[model samples]
Target chain A: MSSAVEEKRKHQKAQKKADRDAALAKKAELNMTSLMDIFVNVLIYLLMNYSTSPVDVPQSKEHTLPQSSTKLEVKHTTTIAVTKKIIMVNRKKVCDVVKNTVDPSLKKDKQASSYLITPLFKELKEDVQKQKKIAKYNPSAAFKGEVTIVADQDMSFRLLSEVMYTAGQAEFSKFKFAVVKKGG
Target chain B: MGKKIRQEDATEEINIMPLMNIIMLLIPFLIMSTEFIKIGVINVAAPKIGGGASSSEPKKKDEKPPLNLTVSITEKGLTILTRGKKIPEGCDLKGEATEAKLPTVKKIGDKHNLPVLKQCLQTIKEVFPDERRIIIMAEPEIRYSIIIDVMDHSREGKTADKDMFPEVVLSAGVL
Candidate 1:
């Protein structure tokens, strides 16, 4: 009787162990495969879009940098980005833009349809003042009146000139147009 | 039974901790390395505020370079002008610029004819080898893409070793 009881106990224990192992394996199998696949995909995407440039602009769906064969490297400066929707000065929203041009109301001299954008000029002037203040403390880091204009390839030339002309009015003289470096 | 449960728990915990650690490290690494877009620059001279000439140097009276190379883009097409004189292109060979202009090169589509434009600039380069500056002007409605493409095409020829006119000064529209 004792030996028979012992055999019954052993069989029960073995069945319980098998059931536990099977449940654990099922759970792990389901999660591991899908999770691993997801992680691998995410990592690949991140690797491809990684950039090494010191200065960069976020390229949106509507905007793309014009391709250039020139070997000029982008320098750090006050950035003015013109999108289809709006114009930005140093990553701050300055004014709204339209399809082919800026709204006249947003400009300084609205009646004349002036090229000088009011908000952009004010913002850039503030930036120049701040830079000048910083330069005063550190003589070696004198302010350079440089501005980088980032815009879509399809943006109109008139808007570009307006931005440059306004920047010029606000003490910025050096103009650099951002582009994607590529072969012809 | 209690000892066996503890051992299983330990193994499960170990499996997740290492994986979590790895993912934690990897995610930050990828994020730190990622930037939205890479961009280069084309240094363009600021438009002359109140200009006699867009050139950086103050002009002497009655003195001008032999070639005041100017390239203009309008609704018609590109018109390369030297000292206000247009460079006429193939078959449109009339003495008058307005009468006969450089027609857009047609291969598959109505593109800017950049390569042919480059070739014309190259020809100009041979004679005015010392001239490094070129003024680019376009109509108000012209796309910035066309302007920059023209600038890039004329900036370098074949390679960086062969520069055509790297210095570009943007001029206001003719209109």
Candidate 2:
């Protein structure tokens, strides 16, 4: 019994020594400012490179796009104009007039009733052929790239059908109907 | 004194964890905004300049060389032009005798006469059977419905049979 009491006294004395050492270690400080500085530098670098470029949106004074609720911004290399009487594909006029010379005896306005679209098809065919000549990044699928159509709001379905049909024939399946952004 | 010197050395070493975090966020931003490739287009036309430039002017044949056709629709009616020349083949009859000769029917449909347009196309095709296909030009003022009517009839013959589809190709042209 006497020996146990002596051992307990010795353990208590060691505990007091450990407490003093711990108090001295607490006086030593860990600096956090350097770690904070590194974090701020990294954050600034990230923010600088965040948003790179603006969306490409082409507009013209001659044509006003129809109103639509779509959010997609078109990125077309070629801009097609749908005018009051002419369809300009990449600034080239393909069909100038619709006429019928045969059977002048039929009527004075027989030619006007008939619509012709041969030149536009030829132009589209040419475009497709030219793209195939370039090296690298060939689109094997149909409706590739930005094809913006500035179709007039009043154009007849008959005429529009021909336009859509022609575009489809040219392998231009993807289409963006140009429209003014609401409230902009 | 040796222990104090060792502690100072530990404080001098830089922490790199924050620098690594910033790089991760920046990479996604650059990739999302980038447009790497653009599709190229080429315009094709009939070869105009041949070597030695065939200077000889060929005699005018009775048949006219193929001319581009343009059709414009307005509130008034459809206007037709061929190479800027006026052509009137599918209009209403003028004389009273022609009106009287028309077949009497209970209904005169509002639907545009497709046959009239087809007949006009037929004549154009006959003149240039090998090259009858044409690009259709119309004004935006024209109705979408009317334009479809015109194209449906632009073919020289019956469109019911796919085999007999008139080879007319449609195109849009600026006024």
Candidate 3:
């Protein structure tokens, strides 16, 4: 009986050792090479398309852009965004839009069917002057009189015209209307 | 001696823990920085003030008038007019006249009949292949988004695989 009990203990010990070895082998079996390859490819792709330019306009829920089939790429310029409630120049609110028209109080200079809004004109003028000053100092950077308008689809032409006219009066002759690129 | 030789020949495992941590951090950073919505631009020249004529010389009586194509958008639909004369039976401008007596276009599929409007514009484009400018006259109540869509349609004719009217002049519709 004593010899039999000793044999049983030895068998249990061997079984436990085998189980532990199997667990360890399983733990060491992970192939990180494939995972590392996938990560490297993803990183390469992301790095290639990474935009370093700081002039990208932040899209928001209120400022959904109209879709277009045009192939023209957007360039860095002063952006004026018109939403349902407000008109913003470079993300700063210049005036409020109500009932498809800019608030009368915001228009300091009132004329019949006036295209220029006072607050917007002042903001765009400052931007143009600052750009001109920068171009004067930096020979490589030239002021191109470019302005980009990113307006909501629900906005009316009256407000757009006023904004464009105001920007034009501010000496921004070249206008670019921002649109969401459609399709591949 | 054989066991010792095998152990010596084993390659050292590289410590990729730091690299893994860096890559994990970089992925989220890149995703957050990436602009998913690709922004495009439609160039527009500021409208010339004072209505200055292109040429200094007086126009000859026999010379054909410039093709001043105007696409007027009202509540009913789109109206294609050339030199102030409406294109007969081409447009489907069908809606109740507004208080201002301006006919508006019916909205088909979240927008005015853009397909029909494109077809109409394409026909006009074939007639005046050389003319590239179109004046988009929209009502004050018309959404700016609709105007842009009309501009896009008028700017290029897809069936022809050519630009119909590249130059767009925005104007408030005749009141």
Task: List ranges where model 3 is wrong by over 4 Å.
Answer: A1-30, A52-55, A110-114, A138-140, B1-13, B47-64, B91-110, B159-161
My TM-score estimates for the predictions, one after another, are 0.77, 0.31, 0.79
Please give the clash total of every predicted structure, in order. 0, 37, 8
* lDDT by residue (tens digit), candidate 2, A39-115: 56655665554433232323344343454323345554445556555677777765432221112222223453333
Q: How big a share of the true inter-chain contacts is recovered in candidate 3?
A: 0.62
Q: After superposition, how far is residue B128 of candidate 3 from its true place, in Å?
A: 1.6
Q: What is the lDDT of candidate 3?
A: 0.75
Q: Lowest lDDT 10-mer window, candidate 1 chain B?
A: B50-59
- Cα lDDT computed for each candidate against the true fold: 0.77, 0.47, 0.75
Candidate 2 local lDDT, B83-148, one digit each (tens): 655455443222232333322111126444545555655555555456543544544445543543
Interface RMSD of each: 4.3, 12.9, 3.8
Ranking of candidates on lDDT, top first: 1, 3, 2
lDDT of 1: 0.77
Residue A91 accuracy (lDDT) in model 3: 83
Tens digit of lDDT per residue, candidate 1, span B49-161? 51312233454554554577888887667778776777676423234554534532322265677787888788778777888889988888889989998898888866669
Model 2: runs farther than 4 Å from truth? A1-62, A97-116, A135-146, B1-175
Which scores greater on TM-score, model 1 or model 3? 3
Name the 10 consecutive residues with the lowest summed lDDT in model 2 chain A: A99-108
In terms of lDDT, the poorest run of 10 residues in model 3 chain B is: B48-57
Question: In order, what DockQ does each candidate have?
Answer: 0.43, 0.07, 0.41
List ranges where model 1 is wrong by over 4 Å: A1-54, B1-23, B49-66, B91-98, B102-109
